[model samples]
Target: MEHLKTFLLKRFRIKDLGDLKYFLGIEFSRSKKGIFMSQRKYALDILQDSGLLGACLDNFPMEQNLKLTPTDGALLHDPTKYRRLVGRLIYLTVTRPDIAYSVRTLSEFMHQPRKPHWDTALRILKYVKGTPGQGLLFPASNNLALKAFCDSDWGGCRATRRSVTGYCVFLGNALISWKSKKQTNVSRSSAEAEYRAMANTCLELTWLRYILQDLKVLQTVPVPLFCDNQAALYIAANPVFHERTKHIEIDCHIVREKLQAGMISPSYVPTRFQLADVFTKALGKDQFVTLRDKLGLHDIHSPT
Candidate 1:
């Protein structure tokens, strides 16, 4: 990586190693095309543990635009099963970004899972059962461009009236990080929620830049952060203080600072192409597949 050379020139000395085969349960393979990482063995073990190794494959991870509420189901007599599945799903999200939101939704009910929560958790397991070989594909490229996508669903959590936020970071076309979670406080408007999500995304971007720098990979250009909300982009580009925008947090201002310093820039993207949408809520089969492909996830065994 040219970036790595650029970064390493200033930092600690380093040595080149040969191709990587495995690390931390994730296996890697390299060819002229690119490097591939997957947790096939781990996925299979999880399915076998849950007794769904031979189950039929699911067409989608979750129901189309599925919504889960805090009070929608009866309390479970035992929560041990639900908790175990949730824990595994969390780790799986490291490679299966498609199920991040659903896993986050299920984890919320860990304290006192209900029937519906348990059912949803099982649905996720069933989905995982079918795709043990699916993983991220990092095609060989000349550049490791950094970019981010962020999205939020206003008042998505029915119980708290708090919005759900999600974002994904990509190095070149390969996904490196992502998240799906709820906002701490209720946002008065959709723009406010979008702003908060952008701020979170900004923090992630900042940290990632540092990591790459530490690894001797330096980004040559400003990271473009994509969002579906125009208001959020406007707020990031402007620097006016108003009472109505007082709730706008200090963290949110970091976006402007990054922009001004040529570290990061905010850009608008259509909701249809917003990759982070997958992390904010469930979607229909067609849309989900589209975003998943965009994120560079494909079945390694599939004939290309």
Candidate 2:
């Protein structure tokens, strides 16, 4: 531990507060309820610095039915500044999944951020202002059932028309792993898009299973992956190659093989219970809050 601290000190300005009460952007508080993570202070500083503290905070980060396209406008006259802002926001994802999907969306345009993109980012800053203390809580629990939720937005990206795949892995009620990523390949149909997303989610689940085995927490029960697409779930259960599925890469078949071997099971879940929905699409304010809370996230500034 001493050597690790020396390495960090030498690389950056050293301000050893003795113990790590906070690191990066997350505020750490330990109690009988287990470790509660929040970023209230960091979120407030970002809002004030971005001059969005006084702006009206919208319940959601982006407006409904909003679309983004490549613009020929001058890409953020100062590219470095835009990059810096993105860097900070990405770090905040450690404790702020509320901004995860939005941050990942803005990151795609980092190569060439236009005025509209910057305005959208500022809007997110304002939204953060309204709920600066919101963060995830890892309550103490022994029932570590490895359940997961996965979903995808069919051709959500306007530029490449590629789909966005998202999944969140939970240990009991605490969200342990989550991702919001754009698929590398484009799908011709919604089912195809969902299949690809499931493949990716399966791969993550497989890795987590192996990781748990290494940690000596291996369970006999198969991991359950809750997906909203019934078609995709059925495809995984059977190996028959349909006309549409044949076009998919051979590597994607790994998911189907894993399912047949009983490593994981893909079950259909209703859209209302899909917690991964927050990572795949921009939702209404109420919907976002509901899913966020389900992920075990709460506002630390609020009285429990």
Winner by lDDT: 1
Across 1-304, the per-residue lDDT of candidate 1 in tens digits comes to 8787779867877765656787777878787888888887888888888888767777777887667776777988878977887898788887788889999988888888888788777777777776777888888874788999999999987788899999999988889999999999899999999999998998899899999999999998899999999988888887886776788858567777888889888899999999999998888889988998898887776567
TM-score between model 2 and native: 0.89
TM-score of each: 0.89, 0.89
| Residue range 71-142, candidate 2, lDDT tens digits | 745567887777778777888888888778888988988888887778778878877877888888788665
What is residue 113's positional error in candidate 1, in angstroms?
Answer: 0.8
Task: Evaluate residue 200 in candidate 2 and report its C-alpha lDDT on the 0 to 100 scale.
Answer: 83
